[model samples]
Target: MSTAVDTGGASDLTLRKEAVTASADNAPTAPEPAVGATRKEPPPEKPSDTRRRSWVVASFWIIVLFLGLPIWWHTTSIYRANLPLDRMLEWSDGKACRPVFPLRISLDPGSLQDQEAENLLRLTQHALDDLNDFPAHHLRLQLAQKEAKQGSDVALTIRLTPGESVHTATSSLHPHLPILDVSYPPNSIPTPMSSSSGLATYIAAQLRSNFAEEQNIINYLLESSTAHQEQRSKSVSQDVAQTLSKRVTRSLKYARTYHLTFSLFTNGPSPSSWDIESAIDQYMRPVLDMLAPIHNFTLDTQVQLYAAPGVQSQVLSKEDLSAFINAAEWPLSPSIGGAPTVNFVVYIGNQTIGTEAAETSQSWLIPQWGSVYLLAPPSSVHVASDTLKQPILTFTSHLLSLLGTPQSGSLPLRLSTLTRVRSADLLLRASSSLGSLARLSLALKSISIPSSVADGVAKSMHHLELACASLGNPESLEHAQIAEAEAERAFFEKSMVGQLYFPDEHKIAVYLPLLGPVGVPLVMGLLNELKAWRNRRRQKAKAA
Candidate 1:
């Protein structure tokens, strides 16, 4: 019975197992991966495709290299005109020009015979040559024509007259002309065979003395200059050098034209009108006319009432004098032209200058700027020419100082000396500017040198050459002015500074964005191509 029960149970369990097997067979089964069918290898790229890709990459690079790069370069490239750097440096170094001032002094035989005048001139020239310390500045004596013409190129004319009562030779300069009147006794007349003569010696001494201040000043300039330092004369004493330095510092820069603005500034509402026109016509016109050859002057006058000075001191110290010009309060605006403006102020105030502080009690000169006069309260509201006489005279004197005229010698002599001095100054200034430009070009490679700049430099050098050739001549001043102007224009070129303002960092900032994205893909593509080619080469070698 137990076996029957066990068989039934087993039969039931077998049926259950069959049922489980049938259910399992009927249920969804997972798909098996085919072992033999592996992933198929991709077909090798076609030669055409490879060629097409290469052409695409090459075209992109070609566009960038040939078209884009050229366009960028063309757009960004600086136009650098060639400059005569060596010649510029030569001029700056004084190697191109050694300025020699051959001052031509004409000797006029007034009462003496032609032969006697010639003998005296020869002996004087000899004496001058022996006494002259500076080789660059030389005085050349020449026989004047029987009739000396007006506006002759001669620096000065020495007229000789025999004085029956005179024991020795005596010289007197013409007050208004560049003529020296020499009176000598008949016995003092130099003979043709005589190596030395008292008259010649006296004349030589006079000439030397007359030109001594000019010589000293020029020597100081050369010594102060970087270019002519080696050629500077050692004869200039320290005191004289200091004095020259002071004068130079005080003097105005060279100009073709100067605007003279005469201003009357009063502390109170009085003296509004002045006879400045008549005063200038009387006291200043002659000097202006004299300077007309070297420089042109434009005169303008104005009156400002209730004007206060920067300093209110009654007795101004040296320091107070410097600060006396009330620049902000005064209507002393420069004249609207290319020429520099020189101011002459007559302040009708109760201010007095200290005796020790000022050279004069009436006025004080403002170096390179102008002059100021302190006038006591005038008797009338309208100042007359006679009342303005002393002040105008002071202004005239100050004008000479501002114009860089030498202190010694007559007005005409001083004016002539001014011409030569100005020529030298302009020459040196132009040369220095050229050197600065050359150095700038070499130092700043990115700077654009325009054709105009090159042209200016060329013009400057040409004028410099001409000026150097005719150093002591009146024409030299004109040439030097042109040279200085050209050099200044070249150095301070607007385009040069304009380009300089656009720096390299700014360029990179402008170009980087355009190049970065384009460059990355090009580089990656090139690298991929190289890797493919290398792999192909290795595979081919293995196959071989």
Candidate 2:
């Protein structure tokens, strides 16, 4: 009975299995089990196609390397014009020029025999040489056969006259001329055989005294310059240097011409008219004429009635003095020319200086700019020339300082010294400019140097050479002027400075976006190709 039950159960199980299998098979045949679409095998690449692809990539790389790279390099490269940097540095260091002042002094031995005159000149020269510590400034003595000519190259003329007193000598400088009148005792005149004499020593001492300030100024300039370090004299003390520094700071730059603007500024409407033209003609004309050789002056006078002072206080302090000129309201605009403008302002006010020091005078020099005079309100509406006399004279004195004239010595001597100082000043300025340009070029490697800059440098160097060669002469002034102008032009080149603003980072920022996307594929393709080529070579070697 149990076997029959087990057989029945097995039959039922088989039936159930058959039913499940049939149900699955008959389910619409499942659309042949939905056979996946056969994937087609890719065709093998032809060697020629592979070679063509490689050639295309290689051509692209070649174009980039040979054409695109060169174009980019050429476009982006900084144009650096060839410059004589070494020569410029040499000039700045004073290795190129040595300045020497050969001052010629003429001797008029009136009433003395030629032999005695020559003897006196010889002894005087020897004494001068002995007394002179600076070798660059030399005084050469020559006998003036004629009446001392005016405005000659001779620095000074010594006119010797016989005096009744024995062993006594007196010297006086001619007010209008560069003549030194020396009255000597007959006994003081040196004999032909005399090696030395008291008169000679006295004359030498006097000349030294007369030129002491000039020597100090020259030494100061040399010391101030980068070049001529060894040529600087030890006689310039700290006090003198300080004074010179102040003076130099106050003095205007050297120029071929200067415009003189005399403005009469008044708080009230009264005294609107002034005799400025007459005052300038009478008081300032002589000085201007004297300065004609060194610089030209253009004068223009104006009267402003409603003008106001910068400081309203009646008592102007030292600080207030600097702001006294209402620069914004005043029509003191610089002249429209290469020449600088010097302003002479005569303000009609009753203001007094707070300090009683000499520096706090009613009229004060504004250093390089010009001068200002605080005048009391005029008694009349029309200012007279006499009323403007004091102010005009003050302006004249300030003008000399503005022109960088030496403080000491007579007018003629001061002017002579001014020439030398200006020459040295211009030379030093040019050299300094050259040095600055060279250093700038070195510092900014990517700055584009235009051909104009190179041309200007060349011109400057040429003019500097000429100036150096003709130092201590009037021709040097012209040469130095040209040199300074050229140097300044080169230094301030617009192109060179403009390039400085577009630095490497700026170029990168402008080019990165375009170059990055384009460069990546090219570089990666080349690298992959190179790697594949190396692997192929290795595989071929192994097969071999």
Quote each prediction's TM-score. Answer: 0.90, 0.88
Off by over 4 Å in 2: 1-44, 147-151, 312-315, 357-361
Counting clashing residue pairs in each candidate, in order, gives 0, 0
RMSD of each: 4.1, 6.2
The Cα error of candidate 1 at residue 521, in Å, is 1.6
lDDT of 2 by residue, 362-452 (tens): 8878877889999999788989999999999999999998888888767987887888788878888899899889988888888878999
Model 2 steric clash pairs: none
Q: List model 1 lDDT by residue over 338-419, tens digit each.
A: 8899999999998878876455487989888899898888888999999889999999999999888999889999999999
Return the lDDT, model 2, position 461: 92
**Candidate 1 clash pair list:** none
What lDDT does the true structure give each of the candidates? 0.88, 0.86
Best by lDDT: 1
For model 1, the stretches where C-alpha displacement exceeds 4 angstroms are 1-41, 148-151, 164-167, 357-360, 501-506
